[model samples]
Target: MNTSIRRALGTTALTTAALLAASGVASAHVSVNAPSAAQGGYTVLEFRVPTESETASTTAVTVELPGLASARTEPIPGWTATTEKDGGDLVTSVTWTANPGAGVPPGEFQRFVVSAGPLPAQDEVEFPATQTYSDGSVVDWNEATPASGEEPEHPSPTLELAAGSDDTVASAVAAPSSSDSDTTARWLGGIGLVLGALGAALGIGATVRSRRS
Candidate 1:
């Protein structure tokens, strides 16, 4: 094989590997959309859950709220919402369940919204969640964030709280729009297609070069 063709093959392989790594990061675990809130203020937050099971639909999701916060859930048309409280009237957790046969199917995702706060004065708060599937399997997204900044296999979704200021407070609850989600999905799909094409082209080029040699 020529040196130039060998270098091209190596470059293509590296590019494809990088794209795969990025795609994995983008969709690895349950995440919060526009996950920022002001310290000691009210804000709405959305938990974005993607269905990961190939054979099971996601039937329910439960999010454990941060300590002793006042919370109200936004209604989702097809799901029923319930709250679990600790002894002294502090809302501890919230669960949303889909009606039978109406859960989020494979290859799709759903968002659960909650209006929660006055948020804690801390820099960040984590919302540990439990995801239940139609086949009775459960995925617990309760892993604490590591100090090394590497994501866990099932990391909990988190919201960063900024020190309250007039301008920061106004933009704290910027929930992601439907169009934004759609655009992200489209971009990921496009990258996957490009990577596949590059892999096939490289394979064909290698085969042709071998035959000539």
Candidate 2:
């Protein structure tokens, strides 16, 4: 009922809100943003990477072509590109690296293009990624294949290659669409806001009554 009690409750509420906001930002790091493999063949795949830090820029992107034996990339100007073979045969698996010119500014994104060879006749292929920031921080986008319904603690953008014809594995990674999932989420959030407002009003009223008594 006292000024001190009101102040403490207000501080606790604000602290909770801040914690939620911070958690949201941390969960929203690097994500895949373009054409997914939709009926795969010799097609160009574009990956978009946006740096998270306002003070740091993105300096490099490394794409690990796991299992796909023959994949190549189109040359990017002002950028250094290289490829390395996986263990076993020299042509079995390859990983490519691209360094951006200068650095990708905060809130800005860069695209990486690579040519995929003929996809496997069946099964899915995941193109995992690792992103490097200008401040010497690296984020690996490779999470467990077939995401477990939970956004991973650390998640990477992945392209799912479905099997059909010889060139059936679609080369397109469709961007996440909010239209299907977030509508109910928004309604629930509105309900939560109303509940929160009601709770605050009750607390204020209780404080007033106690002070009068």
Candidate 3:
């Protein structure tokens, strides 16, 4: 093969391998998401747990919520949920245990949902989790990311709290609105989307050609 063609093929192969590896490891990391959660607000939180063990199933999970005002877990048919509260009766932690033969199997995942909180008034919140496998092993997803922002091998589930909803709405209402400006912005956004799609298509075509060569 010519040098250029060989380089293109090598780049494509490396890119493909990187993507596959990322996707493979991503699910193995337990994570949480609450897109609309705001400071001192109540919102639904979803904690997604994946069974990372090749030979064992996930049997239990425990999440720490030290300052949450309250929490309620959405019931899973084959799972039982419990909470522990501090002296002031605020939920401090929650645990979910899978029933017999109901553990999340290897390569599969389950999302545990919670409707909780007057969330703590903090910029970031971490929900450190402990995972138990049916094979009598436990894993802690409790490491805090350092100031350098490099993710730890088993990073804790975290959420960055936004400003309260009232502040957001007030800010939006305070912004000047103009039909003409809105129209122009939408037109530009549409063009950007079209260009982005075309770029992706060309990228795919180039990769396919490199592979077929």
Question: Scored by CA lDDT, what does every candidate get?
Answer: 0.83, 0.63, 0.87
Better of 1 and 2 by TM-score: 1
Ranking by lDDT: 3, 1, 2
Report the lDDT tens digits of candidate 3 across residue range 118-207. Answer: 776678899999999999999999999999988789999999989777664354334332444677799999999999999999999999
Instruction: Arrange candidates by TM-score, descending.
Output: 3, 1, 2
Candidate 2 — what's its lDDT? 0.63
Candidate 1 has its poorest 10 consecutive residues by lDDT at: 169-178
Q: Which regions of candidate 2 fall more than 4 Å away from where they truly are? A: 1-29, 32-40, 87-101, 121-123, 145-148, 166-213
Question: Candidate 1 regions off by >4 Å?
Answer: 1-6, 165-213
The estimated TM-scores of all candidates read 0.70, 0.54, 0.74
Q: By lDDT, who's the top model here?
A: 3
Residue 101 in model 1: lDDT? 60
| Better structure of 1 and 2 per lDDT | 1
Please, what are the lDDT tens digits per residue for candidate 2 over residues 1-213? Answer: 699999999999999999999886654555543344544454566776777778888788877664444557667655666676644322232333445457678878777776665544435555677778778998887886354576665566665654445324443222222342367689999999999999999999999999999
Clashing pairs in 3: none
Among all windows of 10 consecutive residues in model 3, the one with the lowest summed lDDT is 169-178
In model 2, what lDDT does residue 20 have? 94
Candidate 1: the clashing residue pairs are: none
